[model samples]
Every structure is written in C-alpha cells, then in structure tokens.
Target chain A: MDWPTFIQSISNAVILGSIYATVAVGLALAFGVMQMANFAHGEFFMAGAYVVYVFYAIGGMPFPAAVLSAFPIVAALGIVTERFIFRPTRGNVLAGFMATAGVAFVLQVIVGQVWGVGLMRSVPTPYMGAAEILGAKVSWQRLLILPATVTMVGGLWFFLHKVRLGKGLRACAQDVEAASLQGININKMTALSMAISGGFAGIAGALMAPINAVTPYMGHSIIVTAFIVVIVGGMASIEGSILAAFILGFIHTFVTTIFDAVLATMVGVAFMAVILVVKPSGLLGRARV
Target chain B: MKYLAALAGLAGFILLPHFIGEYYVEIMILFMINLILASSFRLITTVGDWSLSHIVFMGVGAYTTALLAKYLGWPFWGTVLIGGMASAAVGLAVVFPLLRTKGFGFFIGSFALGEFIRLIWVKFHFPFGGPRGMIGIPSIELGDIDFYEATPYYYLVFIFTVLCQVVLYRIDLSRTGRVLKAIYADEDLSKCIGINVARYRAMAFSVSAFFAGIAGVLLAHRLGAIDPKNFDVNTMVYLVIWVVVGGVGTFWGPIIGVAIMMVIGEAARPLAEWRPLLFGGILIVFLTLLPGGLENLILRFKEMLEKLRSAGESQPAE
Candidate 1:
C-alpha cells in the first residue's frame, strides 16, 4: 500500500478502534459489576443511533446536543432492562444474557414499527469537512470520535478510581456479598453499571449515525463485534475491553483493506477464537475462580 | 395413558393434513422441521451448553445438500445423509476450540465461529451463490411419488420428525443422555465419576448439529430455494427462545414449546410487523416469570392434580 493509503488506513483504524471501545466498554462494565451480559447491547447502540436520527435528523436539534442526549436516553433503556429483564433472571447468568435477545427483538420491532424498517435512515452529517493529517485526508466527523472516546474512557477511569459510587460498583464486581455486607447496595451498583454501559454504547452509536446506515437490524453485525471485543478483552475487564477493541478494530480495518469485509469479519472471529484457546481469560483479564 | 395420548397425537398428525388447506399443510411441514431443530437443540442444552449455531448447522445442511444436489445431481436420501454428516463434522470443528470455555465464553465463541462459517457462504459466490442464495433446487423424487405436492411433502417431513424424535428420545433415555445430564448437573462431580465430559459434550453438540442439518435439508427442499440470510443469528435467537420458553429439561418440553409457539405464530399472522414484538414479549415473560418454561407449568399442574386426588381420597376415609 502507498504511504497516503497506509496513513488513511491507520487513521481509519483509530476511528474504528474508538467506536469499538465505546461499544465494548459498557458490556465489560455491566458484566463486571453484575454478571449481567447483555445480548441486546447492540440494540442499545442502535437505539442510540436512532436517538440521534430522531433528534438531530428529524427534530432539527443541534447534532452535538442530539448526540449528547443519546447518553441519557439509552442509559435509561439500560436501567429499565436491568430492572425488568436482568434483575428477575439474575440467578441464571445465561438466561439473563439470553433474555436480552428477546429485548433486542422487542427493541428492533418497536423501532422498525415506528420509523419504518424498509430502508436505512440516513442521518445527514453536521461536520462536513476533511482534515489532512500527515499525507492522509480524514473526515472531521471521524476524527471527533478519538477525543470523545478518550474523554469518556478517561472520565470512566476517574469515576471508577475516584468516585465513591464507582468504587462501590468496583467493590460489588469484586465480591457481591462482601460489597453488600460493607453497605453497598448491589442493586444500585448493578443499575449504575448498566446505566454507564448504556450511556457509553449510546454515544458511540450517536457518533456513528451519520457515518453508518441507521436500521433496526443494524445491531446484528455490531453485537457480534461487541461480543468478540468483550470476550477477547477479558469478559469483565474494562481495560482489556479497550485494548481488545482497538486490536480488533485494527485487525478488521487492515484485513478489510487487504481482502474484503466478509473476510475481515471472518479473520476477526478467527483471531478471537485463537485468543480464546491461548488465553481464555482474555489478553489482560484475570482468571475467575 | 401416556401411550394412548402419543398414539392419538400420531394419528392426528397423520390425518390433519388431509383436512387442512394446502397452505396450512405447508405450515405444519415447517413446524415439524422446527420441531426437529428445537429438540436437537435441547440435546446440546442437556449438557448445559446452549449453542447459538444450531440454526447455522441447519444452514450447513441446506447448503451442503443444495450444492451436492444442484451440481452433482445427487438423490434426496443421499443428500440428506451427507448433509447430516457434513453438519456434524462442522459442529465438531466449531465445538473443538469451544471446549476451553464454558457458560458465557462458550456462548460467544460459538457465535463467532458460527458467523465465520456463515460469512464463508456470503463471501463465496462461486458455489454458494453469495448473499442472493441458491434457487431452483430440485424437489424430492422417490419411487414415482409426486413429492412436490403438499401431502407428500408433509408426510415426508412427518416421517423424518417421528424418526428423529424417536432416536433423540431414545438417546435422552439412554446412558449417554444420563452422562450428559450429569455433566450439566455437576461437571466436576461427573469428571470424578470417570465421565468423559469433553467427549460427551462434543458428542451431544455434533449429534444436535446433525439433526439440525436434517431439518435444514427438509426446509431447503420445501422452499426449493436457500438463502444465507435464512440461517442468520435472528433465526438462532428464535431457536433459543423456543428452547427457553419450552424448557429443555425434558424430552417433550421443546416439542410442546414448538407447538405452542407455532400456533401462536400462525394465529398472529394478522399482526404482521408487530408479530416479532409479541414473540419477544413472550420470551421475556417466560425467562423472567417462568424460567422453567411451560413444561414446569405442566409438571406443577400434574402435581396439583395428584394432590387434589389424594386430598379427596383422605377426606372420604376420614
């Protein structure tokens, strides 16, 4: 590949990695805190995109404002899911996880019914300029994702390390009984974790809405990618998720550049499978007893 | 009494198509195909590993038969057998690496592998027809019987369903099935007892995939066309919903689940775009409130009836 193309690919990889981190981080958080693995996380991401579509595209709200709004909207969805779906099925982790598939279906149908499922909804890009970095030209909209991800992930790190409630969530993840005994409400922590998970996924979707086609079933492909990221990152390790997400993003982009999207996805899955065999706990995940 | 109910149900299945319209007969065929799919899925779950690839295995079978029959002009019976074997082989390969993890890890890993296999079909247009899928698949031809007719096809599926169910039921009742159940109940304990946990788990997965392939074969011929989209994760999730809603604890649970859901599905035809929402709602309800599924409800009802009978008998004695 030429220098310009290589630079372009590297920039694209960064953008892809940012999006994957944003989507997978919440999944890792939710799983860490509550063992509540959401199968509908992609749907949550899709809902976030639709939030941007409905607010910025249709309602004529400012793009940044609409994107910001996805956090609360999808976070509320996460909380509701935790209460109704995750809470009741908590004892059986698999059941709780699988039930989210039902949630995914419900969300897809609801969104499809309301917004019309036949064609993809195109959210017009508000930032419509390209920037020259090195020799490669990258879109401003795509570059915006890098700072947004860094800020969100950085802010999350601060919250988990500094904030009392975030510490409670971490404690709950480490030992539910101990955390509960120590006066942490497990329910609240789980809910909070899910909220953050939803919020992160939502913002990722909102940012991508203008770039990706908006569809009800769009969650299908993304959920697969998120699951791969979560598994490869170490099922419950937030740092691992971020690292794996970028690694997968690079793998996906470079492989796609070399071959095709289908082969790239296949390569991604193969990479995940190999990782699973070598380090089942993930690249940086601690082994669970 | 159980034998009598089974006989009557069998008789009803044989005669129903004669009375119903051709469209309904076709629906019944699809229902039976799903019955095989769900029951085989329950087989894997007996080992406590719920695969998201069972439907994809069906796709494997369909595509296998589609390629062989279309290109090589293989006969129906030969294609079906090969399809089952092909799916089992693929299932073994997929489950091989998955042996390292359990629960959530296995679930996600299987999905990735399943998607990988599916993308192969989507990526290759030379033989698999890419995303558009294959059409003009030749219908079954056996001994001068017009297999294209609804009745013949229904009977064909019925025979396969009964045969598959009987074998699966026998397996469930067999020692192998017990060992699988033991693995699910306590893996460590099963290992201590000299059970080859990995071997049995692999066996169950392959067998399940084998049956799923058969269902796919039946479906491919019925539709006379196959698409990559037909075997996607959405279909797999629907299978999960069936097994979950029906409860895979017993051999008959998935059968009952498939029957009830199929009926609900047919009845909800008027709902059209809203149908998936209702089914999704049912899945959530069953998982949250009735996690043991309708089978648990039936078992509870049976226990309640027995309690009522004993209570009446004691009252009379008193």
Candidate 2:
C-alpha cells in the first residue's frame, strides 16, 4: 500500500477502535459491578443514535445539541432498567439474560415500528470538510470522534479514580456485601454504573450516526463484536476491554481493507477461537471461583 | 398402565399422517425435529452448563449431510448417520477443553467457537456452499416408495423423534444420569465422591450433540436447503430460549416449550410487524412470572391436586 493510503487505513482503524472502546467499556463496567451481561446494551447505543437522528434530522435541532441530549435520556433509561429489571433478576443469571434478550428484541421492534425498516436513516454530517496532515486526508467528522471519545473516557477514568462515590462504585463491584457493610448502597452503585455505561454507549452511537448506517438491526452485529472483544479481554475489566477493543478493531478494519468483510469476520472469529484455546480465561482476566 | 399409554401414544403418532393435511403434517414433522433439538439441549444442561452453540451442532450435521450427499452422491440415510457421528466426534474433541473452563468463560468460548465454524462455512464455498447456501438436497427414499411426500417424511420424523426420546429417557434413568445429576447439584462434592465430573459432562454434551445432529439432518431434508444464516447467533438464541422456557432439568419440558413456541410462531405470522415485539413480551413475562418455567407450573399443580386428595381422605365425615 502507498504511504497516504496506509495512513488513511490507520486513521480509519483508530476511529473504529475508539467507537468499539466506547461501546464496550460500559458493558465491562456493568459486568464488573453486577456480574450480569447486559445484552440490551447495544440497543442503548442504537437508541442514542436514533435520538440524534430524530433531533437533528427530523426536528432540525443542531447536531451538537442532539448529541448532548441523548446522554441524559439514555442514562435515565439505564437507571430504570437497573431498578426494574436487573435488581429483580439479581443472582439469577439466566433470568437476567432472558430479560435483556427480551429487552433487545422489544427495542428493535419498537424502532422498526417507529421508523420504517425499509431504508437506512441518513444523518447529516455536522462538519463536512477534510484535513490534510502530511499528505494523508482525514475527514473532520471522523477526527471529531477521537477527541469526543478521549474526553468521555478521561472523564470516566477521573470519576472512577478521583471521586469518593466512584471509589464506592469500585468497592461495590469488588465485593457487594463488604461494600454494603461499609454503608455503600449497592443499589445506588449499580444504578450509577448503569447510568454511566448507558450514557457512554449512547454517546458512541451518536458520534457514529453520521458515519454508519442507522438501523434497528445495527445492534446485532455491534453486540456480537462487543461480546467477542469482552471475551478476548477479561470480562469485567475496563482496561482490558479497551485494549481488546482496539486490537480487534484494528484487526477487523485492516483485514476488511485488504480482503473482504466476510473474510475479515472469519479472521476475527478465528483469532478469538485461537485465544480461547490458548488462554481460556482471556488475556487479562484473573481466575475467578 | 404406563405401557398401555406409551403404546397408544405410539400408535397415534404413527397414524398422524393419515389424518392431518400436508401443511399440518409438515408442521408436525418440524415439531418432532425441534423436540429432538430441545431435548438434547436439556440433556446438555443436565451438567449445570448451558451452551449457546447447541444449534451449531445442528449446523454441523446439516452441512455435513448436505455436502456429502450433494458432492459424494452418498445415500441420504448414510449421510444422515455420518453427519450425526461427525457432530459427535467434534463434540468429543472439543468438550474436554471447553468444559475445563466454566461460567461465562465457557459461554463466550463456545459462542466464538460456533461463529468460527460458521465463518468457515461462509468462506469455503467449494465444500459447504458459502453464503448462498446449498439447495435441492435429495430426499430419503424407501424401497419402491419415495419419501418425498409429506406423509412419508412425517412418519420418518415421528419414528426418529420417538426413538430419540426413548434413548434420552433411558439415559435419564441410568447410572450415568445419576452421576450427571450429582455433578449438577455439587460438582466439587461429586468429584470428591469419585465421580468423574468432566468425563460425565463431556459424555452428556456429546450425546446432546449427537441428537442435535440428527435433528439437523431432518431439518435439512425438510427445508431442502442449508445456509450459514441458519446456524447464526439468532438461531442459537432461540434454541436456548426453547430449552429455558421448557424447563432445563425436565425431560419433557422442552417438548412442551417447542410445541407452544412453534404454535405461537405460526399464529403470529399474520402479525408480521408486531410478532417480534409480542415474542419479546412473552419471554419477559415468562421470565418474571414463570421463572421455573411451564414444567414447574405443571409439577406444582400436580402437587396441589395430590395434597387436596389427601386432605379430603383425612376429613372422612365432612
């Protein structure tokens, strides 16, 4: 490949990796704290994209405002889901899975009903120009995602490390009974985790709305990819999830560019199989009894 | 009395094709095939481990049967047996390494493994017919009688379903079944008591895979096509739902679950747009209200009836 084309591929890989990281980090958080895999997580991301699509495309609201609006809306939905669904299904893994799976299907059907499932929604790009950096062309819209993701992830890191409530959240994730004994409300921590996680997914969806086709079934592929990333990383590990997401993102993007999407998917799945065969617990996962 | 009930049920099943219409007969055959799938899924769950890739075993069987029959010109029946054995062999080879991991690790591991197999199906078109899927699968034939019609296929499916159920029923009541139950209750304790937990779990999975393969072969013949999309995650999810809704621990639970689900699916066909939403709602309601599943409800009701009978006997004068 030429230098410029190679640079473009790298840029695409980085952008895609950032989105994957954003989407998966929330799932890692929820799994870490609750020991439940939120199967409807990608739906939250889809909902966020729709939020932006409705506000900006249909209502003519500014893109930035629509993006900002999705965070709170999706976060509220997350809290409600935690309170109603996850709380009741506590300690019942199968129930939680079924409930989430049901939620995913419900959300998809609702979206399909609202927006006709025939054609994909087109979200207009807020920034339409491209930048030339050392003979490599990068679209402003694509570049914006990098900074937005960095800010969100950085803020999340700060919240988890530097804040008291964040420390309680971590403590609760580590040991619910002990954290409760120490006066940390397990319910509140769980709600908080879901809120943050859902908001992150929504924002990721909002950012990608311009670049990718927005459809109800979009979550299907996204969730599967997230599952693969989460497993390749240690489940419940935020750092591990981010690292794995980028690794997979690069692998998928680079392969797709060189070969075809079908072959790329095959290669990615093969990589996961080989990893499972070798490590089993995953690269960074600690053995849990 | 039990023997009489079994004989009557068998006779009814055998004579079903004569009374039902062709379309209805097809549905019943599909139900029989699904029963095998769901029962095998339950068998695997006996070891306290649930696999999302259970349907992939079906895919393995379907693809194996389709390819061998199409390319090698093998007899349909021979291919069916070969396909099932192939699935069993693959199950045995992977079960040891897979069962070594537990919890969500095993769950995700099997899922990836399944997807990997599917990718191979899509990538290697020469052998497995890629994304377009293989079509025009030859139908099974008996001596001087082609089983191409609905009646013959229905009878074939009914016989296999009964045979599979009989085998599974025997296994469920055997010494190995007892060991599997013990492992499910307390794996560490079962190991301490000299039960080979891993070996038994692998055995259960292999048996489950074997039946699943048989079901797959039947499904391929019924549809006359096999595609990569047939064994995707969505199909796997539905299979898991069938097992869960039917009651994982009960042998007959999945039978009831699959029958109900298939009926619901057919009934919901008119509601095309709203069907998925309705299906999701049903799942949620079942999860919240009937968490132990339909079988549990029946068991509880039976227990209540027994208690009422005893109470009436005790109150003699009243």
Candidate 3:
C-alpha cells in the first residue's frame, strides 16, 4: 500500500477505535456501577441514531442541534429502563438479563415499525470536505469523531476522578450498601450511570450515523462487537476497554484492508477466542467477579 | 400417577401422526426439535451457568451432519450421530476453560466462542457452504421407505426427543443432578463439601451440547437445509427465553415453555412484523410477573386447587 493509503488506514483505525471506545466505555460504566450487563446498551446506541435521523435528516434540524438533542433523549430512555425494568429485577441476575433482552427486542421492533425493516436510512454528512494529515486525506466527519471521543473520555475521567457524585458512583460500584451508609443514594447513582452511559452511546451513534447504515438491526452487529470488546477488555475496566478497542480496531481495519471484511470479522473473533483461552478474565480484567 | 401421566403423554405422542394434518404435524415436529434444544439449555442451567451458545452446538451438529450427508454420501442416521458426537467433543474441549469462568462472564465467553465458530462457518465455503447454506441433504431411509414427509420425520424426532428428555430427566434426578443443584445453590459450599464443581459443570455442558446436537441434526433434516443464519444469536436468544419462561430449575419447564412459546409464535404469524413486538411484550410480562415461570405458576395453581378440595371435604362435618 502507498504511504497515503497507510496513513489513511491508520486514521480509519483510530476513528473506528474511538467509536468502539465510546460505546464500550458506556457499557463498562454501567457494568462497573450497577453490576448489570445492560443488554440493551446497543439499543441505546440505535436510539441515538434514530434521534439524529429524525431531527437532522427528516425534521431539518441543524446537525449540531440534532446531535446534541440525542444525548438527553436517549439518556432519558436509559433512566426509564433502569428505574422500571432493571430496578424491579434487582438481586436476580437472570431476571435482569431476561428483562434487558426483552427491552432490546422491544426497541428493535419499535424502531422497525417506525423506520421499516431492512431499509437503511441515509444521513447526509453535516460537515463536508477532507483534511490532509501526514499526506493522508481524511474526511472531516471521520476526523471529528476522534476528538469528540477523546473529549468524552477525558470529560468522563474528570467526572469520575474530580466530582463528588462521581466518587459516590464509584463507591456504589464497589459496595452498594457501604455507599448507602455513606449517604450516597444507591438508586441515584445507578440512575446517573445509566443516563451517562446511554448518553455516551447515543453520541457515538449520532456521530456514526452519516457513515453507517441506520437500521433497527444495525445494533445487532454493533452490540455483538461491543460485547466482544468489553469481554476481551474486562467487563468493568474502562481503560481496558479503551485499549482493547484500539487493538481490535487496528486488527479489524488492517485485516479488512489486507483481505476482506468477512475475513476481518473472522480474524477478530478468532483473536477473542485465543485471548479467552489464555486469559478468561480478559487483558486487564480483575480476577474478582 | 406420574407413570400414568408419562404413559399418556407417550401414547399421545406416538399416535399424533394419525390425527394431525400435515401442516400441524410439521409444526409439532418443529416443536419437538425446539423442546430438545430448550431442555438441553435447561440442563446446562442446572449447573448454575446458562449457555447462550447452546444453539451453536446445534449448528455444529447440523453442519456436521449436513456436510457429511451432502458431500461424503454418508447415511443420515450415521451422520446425525457423528454430528452429535462432534458437538459433544467440542464441548469437552472448551468446557474446562469455560467452566472456569462464573455467571455472566461464562455466558459472554461461550457466546463469543459460538460467534467464532459461526465466523469460521461463514468464511470457509468449500466445506460448510458458507453463507449460501447447504442444500439437498438426503432424508433418512428406513428399508424401502423414505421418511421425508412430516409424519415419519415427526415420529423420528418424537422418539429422539423422548429419549433425550428421559436421559436428561434421569440425570437431573440422579446423584449427579443433586451435585449440580448443589453447585447451583452454592458453588463454594459444594466445593468445600468435596464436589468437583468444574468436573460436574463440564459434564453438564457436554450432555447439554449432546442433546443440542441431536436437536440441530433433526432441525437440519426438518428444514431440508442448513444455513448460518439458522443458528445465529437470535436463535440462541429464543432458546434462552424458552428455558427461562418454562422454568429453568424444573425438569419439565423447557417442555412446557417451548410448547407454549412456539405455539404462540406460530399463532402470531398473522401479525407479521408485529410478531416480534408481541413476543417481546409477552416475554417481558412473563419475566416481571412470573419470574418462576409457567411451570411454577401451574404448580401454585395445582396446590391451590388441592387446598380448595381439602377444605370442601373438611366442611362436610361443619
């Protein structure tokens, strides 16, 4: 491959990795805080895509406004799901799983009813034109994703490290009852986690809407990939997920460029299998539950 | 009374072909296949871990049988057994590492393994037919007769289904079953009590994979073809739902759940795209309201009816 192509491939890998990092980090946050898997996390991503599709594509709202609007809309949905479905199913892991799985199906069906099944929606790019970076041509849209993801991750780190509520969230994640004793309302922390997690996923979805085929079934592949990433990174480890995402992102992109997308997926999965066999807890996964 | 009930159920199954229409018979055959899959899923759950890859085991069995029958010209019966054994062997290979993980970790791990297998199936076209799927799998032949229609195949599936259920039921009620239940209840306690938790869990997974293999083989024949899509995550989700809604801890929960859910799925066919919505709604309701599942609900009703009858008898003196 030429230098420009190589540079482009690296940039593509970074962009893809950033998207995965954003989505997987949300999952890590939710799992870290609640000890719940949130099977509907991908649906939240899908909801974000639809939010943008509705506002920017159909409703003619400005792209920035549509993207901003998706955060709160999907976050509210996440809060509702946590309060009604997850809260009631607490203490029963299987019940939580079933309810979340049910929620995923419900979201898919609703999206299908609104958008029609098997039809992909087209979302025009908000900002058009390419930028040159190290002799490689990069689309502004793809370039924006990297900084946006970085900002989100950096902001999240700040929130978790510097904010009191963030400390309370961590405390709840460590031990819910202990956190409660410290006057940190466990329910509120969980709700906050869901909202932030959902909002993060939604933002990722909105950013990728122009590039990806927006369909109800879009979440299926995305969720599977996210699950693989999350598991390979360690379920509750945000840093691990970020690192794993970049690794997987490069693996997938390089393989796809060299061979084909189908082979790339196979390679990615094979990589996961090998990792699982060697380290079941994942790359940075804690040995504890 | 239990024996009588079993006998009646068996008799009804045996004579089902004579009474039902071809279409309904096909449905029953499909139900029987799902019953095996669901029950096998429950078998794994007995060990305190649920596998989402159960359907992939079925896929393994199906592809094994299909490839052998289609390419090597092997007899269907021989290929089915070979397929099932292949699935079981794969189970044995992965069970040790897999059982090491607990709870949701194990679940996700197994699912990833399943996805890996599927990707291989999709990537390698010569052997497994890749995405287009394998077609023209020869039907089983029984001495101058071909069991291609719904009736004969229904009987074949019914017999295998009963055999699998009986074996699983025996295991569930045996000492091994007790050990598995103990593991489920408290793994650490079971380990302290001298039970090799990993060994028993592996055994449970192997047995479950074996039955899932059988179901896959039957499903491949029933559909007359096998596709990568047939054993994907959606099927895995449905199998999990069946096991959960039927009552995972109970021996007969999967049977009831598979029957009811498949029937409902078929009945809701007219709804078309709305079928999934209806299905999801029903599943959510069941998860929230009947966490113990349909089997538990039936048990409670039976207990209440017995109490009412006893009250009526005692009121005679009053």
TM-score for each predicted model, relative to the true structure? 0.98, 0.96, 0.96
For model 3, how does the per-residue alpha-carbon lDDT over B1-318 read when each residue is reduced to its tens digit?
999998998899899889878999998888888888888888888888878788999999999888887788898779878888999998887677776677877787788778778877888888888888888888888786668877888888888988888888898899999999999999899999899988899999998898889888888877878888988988787877777678875888988899888888888899888877776777777777788789999999999999999999999989
Docking class of 2: medium
Off by over 4 Å in 3: A287-289, B306-318
The top-ranked prediction according to lDDT is 1
Best by TM-score: 1
lDDT of 1 by residue, A1-289 (tens): 8888899999999999999999999999999988999999999999999999999999999999999999999999999999999999886788888889889989999999999999999999899999999989899999999999999999999999999999999999898999999999899999999999999989999999999999998887888899899888898999999999999999989999988898999998998888888899998889630
**Order of candidate numbers by lDDT, starting with the best:** 1, 3, 2
lDDT of the candidates, in the order given: 0.92, 0.84, 0.85
> Runs in model 1 with CA error above 4 Å?
none
What value of lDDT does candidate 3 attain over all alpha carbons? 0.85
Q: Candidate 2: list runs displaced more than 4 Å.
A: B316-318
lDDT of 2 by residue, A184-256 (tens): 9899999999999899989988888998899988888888888778777877888888898899889988899
Error of 3 at B282 (Å): 2.5
Error of 1 at A59 (Å): 1.8
With a 3 Å backbone cut-off (N, CA, C), the pairs that clash in candidate 3 are none
- List the per-model TM-score of the A chain: 0.98, 0.96, 0.95
